[model samples]
Target: MRDDEFLAERFEAHRGQLRAVARRMLGSAAEAEDAVQEAWVRMSRSDTTHVDNLGGWLTTVVGRVCLDMLRSRRSRAEQPLEPEAPVPAAVPDPEQDVLLADSVGSALLVVLDTLTPAERLAFVLHDLFAVPYDGIADVIGKSPAATRQLASRARRRVRGARSADSDHVTPARRRELVDAFLAAAREGDFEGLLDVLDPDVVVRTEAGVTTGASAVAKGAATYSRHMVGVPVPALVDGATGIALLRDGRVERTLAFTFVHDRISVIDITTDRERAARLKITLL
Candidate 1:
């Protein structure tokens, strides 16, 4: 085979892994495809004669592209958090797509959206994908210790949102907390809302990020008073949540992650396309 053909074969072998990494980094399948394509373009232009581990090199390229895309999105305040369209298949294996979707559920995506660009990359690469901290530091331009810290903070946030302690939180328990939050919001009870929200709770929306119970409560109060449709209780990506329907279609989705009976994170999306992408079941 010619040299170019050899390079193409190697690139194809790692395409699926690169696409998966991109998808997790960017919440949109379309964007993930773009990132992977961009990586290929860069590799095609560079001289890879000295590269021993092509997979690692490609992963680094994809990560850098994803990091740039995420930072650019953050710079533009109007970008929506969730994106429409099914994530393109990394390979032709249908089973792989199913497994990937099942693994990266909506609840996880919601929580990830709250992380900063550097933190998200660090956590996704190191924690989820098992990339070494040193490897991740090179991608984000941070010291190994700092990169580890970013992943550590992200891990704490993810754990707090989705705790593994099976004893305390049941489906019914989660529903009760969500209902309580709605009740407080509707009644414009700021203190009541705070009572149920974790002290360092995070509320993320298209508008921006709000941290702390007090600030989240203040915004929740306003949202409650202006709510148009009655919210139906539901499970969003296997987590307790709610959906507002209009004309028999989901107009809004509110996904929550709890820690020890208090809400640690709340992800609210009013964008129609984004809400449709979530696995929602009205109760």
Candidate 2:
């Protein structure tokens, strides 16, 4: 094979692993693909004759690309973008998507989103992918010690956010809070809804993010007036949540994040296709 063709083959060999790293770092399949492609482009333009480990080189390239994307994403006020239009023959496989979601867990992704770009890169590369601190430090432009600290902070935040063992709130308590929220929503009891929500709760939907307990509660009350489905308790992505069923089919899902007995986050999924991919178990 020609030298260029040989290089392409080598890059292809590491594509899957690079894409996996980007997916976790960016939390979006489309963005992950873009980052991997950018890495391939950079590799093609550079001379890797002395590079001993091509896989590690490609990983660092993809990591840098994803870090840049994350920083840019934050500069834009960290708004979640609308779902990309489907590309011909490029639509993600439902099974693969589910597997990826299961591997990382949607709740973990939400928590990761709260991390800074450097902290995220440090945590994801070192903790999730087992990259060395020295290599990860090079990617984020930090010393190995600083990079380790970033990962440590991110680790504590992740554990505090998702690990049931780290938090005082038990699973049963979470279920009770979600049940109360659902009941209040269904009954248009605004004050009851406020009782279960944190003062600074955040609600995220396809439309946009709504913050503050009063604002979220108002929206919930309005939704109840025109609601058409039966909202039942369910474990959404392994987190206590509710699923709205219409005609025996799930129509929407509400995933909750509780902090000290009050719901701090409410992620609402209204897209049927996306909702179908969530690992939900009815309670």
Candidate 3:
């Protein structure tokens, strides 16, 4: 075979691995395929006369390309995930794909979205890809200690969210609690809602235009107070509820977490702009 033929064959052999890495980074299968195609083009045109360890070099190139793609795609602060298309029964189940599109997968990705770019990359490489801390440092251009620090913050957030159970409740059970909470919120049922909440249940918000911790607690309380008898409206889907005060319109995003039979936690981020888009009403 000609020299060009050998290179072409090599590309075909490792292309699947490259696509997987790109998909992992990009979070979109279509984008990953496109990135790999572009990488192959760059490889074909380059002067590779002295190139060694083709696979390692290719891996590096693919990772860099993916990082670039991820940066460009970062503007959407809250990424609404697209549902997987229905698969034919004849086709064997795609276990990995199923995992990626399931409730747990969605939960993980949503939590990951809260991390900083550097932190996200570090956590993904270390936890998701099983990359060593030293190598993760290399990819993220941080000292191993710094890399570990980033992962530390990310891990803490994940664990705190997961362990938020006031009572022992599995993930599936917690999801149901969230549904009931949203129902009460929509209907404005403070008594019914508070019934499910521990008297001292924690509700807090991050700083912004909205009132500080004291203020949000009062607002949520007021919501229940005014609507004491009104039934909270039905919440859609009920995966989990996130509230934020939009920068311009609403006072905050009121995100919630559920545990056992009660609403375990409430986190309100005061983003007035997001609130405006969400069209949340504030009394």
Candidate 4:
């Protein structure tokens, strides 16, 4: 294959993930597509013989492009783009991904939206991509320590926002207990489900939206009682069923998070007014 063909193939294979990353940063699919395409164009112009990690290089380029886009988009006074779109409610696999869909989850993306463009760019490059602070300083125009500080600050914000939604609980282990609890709930073994609870376990919903453990208790019992239960609808796979009440079967996409083996949060989205371009199923 020709050099251009090789580049095109690589670009095609990674474009979806790249677009998703850019979209999370810019909050617009259109701009994300543009950023990725621009990255492709820029990469295509470079000699590939010396490029190291294609994923890293492409991710860096896209991150920079997204940062530039955000800078340009502001000053126009458009209503903040509605929080980043949630990952699709259902995906090809489930067993593999029990925790949050991706680090770029809707909640994380929302928190990212609150970041200054410099902070977002710095955080994504160094923290998410493992780009060195020196490398990131070049991208965001900050010194290494400043870059470090920026990412640390960004993480604190992310951690704080997450605390509001799901606490400091390990997202993966939380998925496990949630899965077991849902299964026990389905079996109508209230004792089995109760075994997982810590008594003080507090289930949460979309940050400030709190649900009584009682509701998760009753709802799980009923869901176990009826409907062919599939964990709340979401694109992430193999989840223990976070946000259990979000109703995934009827809606095409939904998401719930579990805390301490009990349903804690539900974040199923139903708005479609701006999503006309994406083929989404509410079922």
Best by TM-score: 1
Decreasing TM-score order of the candidates: 1, 2, 3, 4
Off by over 4 Å in 2: 79-103, 106-108, 164-283
Residues 59-151 of candidate 1 have per-residue lDDT tens digits of: 999999998998788666434445554445545577766654554554245434777778889987875567898899999999999999878
Tell me the TM-score of each prediction against the true structure: 0.60, 0.55, 0.53, 0.50
Give the number of the best model, judged by lDDT: 1
TM-score of 2: 0.55
Poorest 10 consecutive residues of model 2 by lDDT? Answer: 82-91
Off by over 4 Å in 1: 78-103, 164-200, 205-258, 266-283
Ranking by lDDT: 1, 2, 4, 3
True-vs-predicted CA distance for residue 152, candidate 4, Å: 1.0
- Extract clashing residue pairs from model 1: none
User: Per-model C-alpha lDDT, please?
Assistant: 0.80, 0.79, 0.54, 0.57
